[model samples]
Target: MTVAALAEVADVSAVEDRHVRLAGVTRVFGRPGTPKSVHALGPIDLDLRRGEFFSVVGPSGCGKSTLLDVLAGLSKPTEGTAEFEGRPIDGVPAGVGVVFQEDASFPWLTVADNVAFGLRRAGVDAAEIARRVDYAVGFMGLKAFAGAYPAQLSGGMRQRVCIARTLVMQPRLILLDEPFGALDQQTRLLMGDELLRLWRETSATVLLITHALDEAAMLSDRVGVMSARPGVFIDVVETGWEVERDSRIVSHHRFGDITGRLWEKLRTESLKHLRDG
Candidate 1:
């Protein structure tokens, strides 16, 4: 199908499935009509189906993070619209969670307390908050370390805690900004498996931004590749992997081919940026 036709279908599906939708979204920094101004992103069109894991990949400075910021309502698009569940997202929308690359865990608080923080802030009752904290901590495999401080945990464990905090809120949509970027290769692969399990269990629509080609292919049902600055999605590739996918997804016959195609598009953009400079 044509790009416009696909987008039109996406809009129709968004209304019925309560998906996240972005139409002609653009983000610009600095003043318009000035040399200092930077057009960082868009006129990008995207639609994320409910319970689907979508990942965005591109070269550095390609506005991958900017796209996530706009979706999370952390920043508004300079032009166009971003909507969640058919409602325009003016600010941080309800039923959404975000996990950044940096450690978000509180040093002083134990894992359980850290997970419970959001519930407490939202005025969730004490008993329900306790219930959710227990569930999330256990689900993220932090049950044994529920009372342990952040400093005592390994990098992977600490990241799990951050994820648990987001999970406790039971968000319908999750935004991850290079959540595994800080980890070693082995740790990142292990965390990828854990994230896949969590995604399956929660059935939350996920939008992840990452520079890792393998990570994106392994974790996403559909992967969108963006251009270099003034980033717009140049193409979207479907992995065609089953929902049971994990780190071992690299073993799949088509994995290499899919990653190669993504790299072809992404590499050209990165080189273009260098040549232009």
Candidate 2:
């Protein structure tokens, strides 16, 4: 499968009305006597517009990942709701794509087969699957290594494969949890550019969770800062970069300013965490 083929399967307009809405969401953990049960998340209220790029950042242990888990339906909030459209999110919502920090491409499956996995699970017709898979593979520029197994690919390529697989699913909302966190600085920058290209081509609402303030600022329309344990959003700073979805946008003047602001905000919250600890 190639990326172009996958892109062909997607209807950009399909994402126009989709959004993720979290209202009064909360989560808690632990027993009655152990230090204080971890609240983990929430009491959050937010609206993620369609085709928009949004990010959440915080200190180590601020429940940023937990928030993603709740959205993915891998974990339930102790209170409130995480909704798609207007309904509560139960399990992985339909048309929702997920790319985790780890490279999840199957070790044994070739790149094409890997990208084809989700569509197959959905019982898509074979021809349709091939088209989508091909599109995804091409979109990620994996043509030369499409036949290679995960172990044969570089880490950056593996992540690209992961992104291809998710895109092939034609998801309306894509959830990325520090997808480039493990990469070296150079590779991370490349992946960010690739991600921006994919987002522009697919037009899906994306919610990315990352610890890197600059990364969040570089890719999102807004970055949500979460407080320490019993995590909840303390502030959301809008980044006006969505209008210029080009990879080169990172080098723009406003980029540094926005990223700096996000950094200060997250750093301040992290200090509060250290104090609380």
Native-referenced Cα lDDT, model 1:
0.92
What candidate 2 gets wrong by more than 4 Å, as runs, is 1-18, 31-36, 275-277
Off by over 4 Å in 1: 1-14, 275-277
Q: Could you give the C-alpha RMSD of every candidate to the true structure, in order shown?
A: 4.0, 8.2
> lDDT tens digits, residues 89-122, model 2?
9987888888999889899899889999888888
Error of 2 at 255 (Å): 1.7
Point to the candidate with the largest lDDT. Answer: 1
Question: What TM-score would every model get versus the actual structure?
Answer: 0.93, 0.89
The most accurate candidate by TM-score is 1
lDDT of 1 at 201: 95
lDDT, residue 199, candidate 2: 86
Clash count in backbone of candidate 2:
17
Clashing pairs for predicted structure model 1, backbone only: none
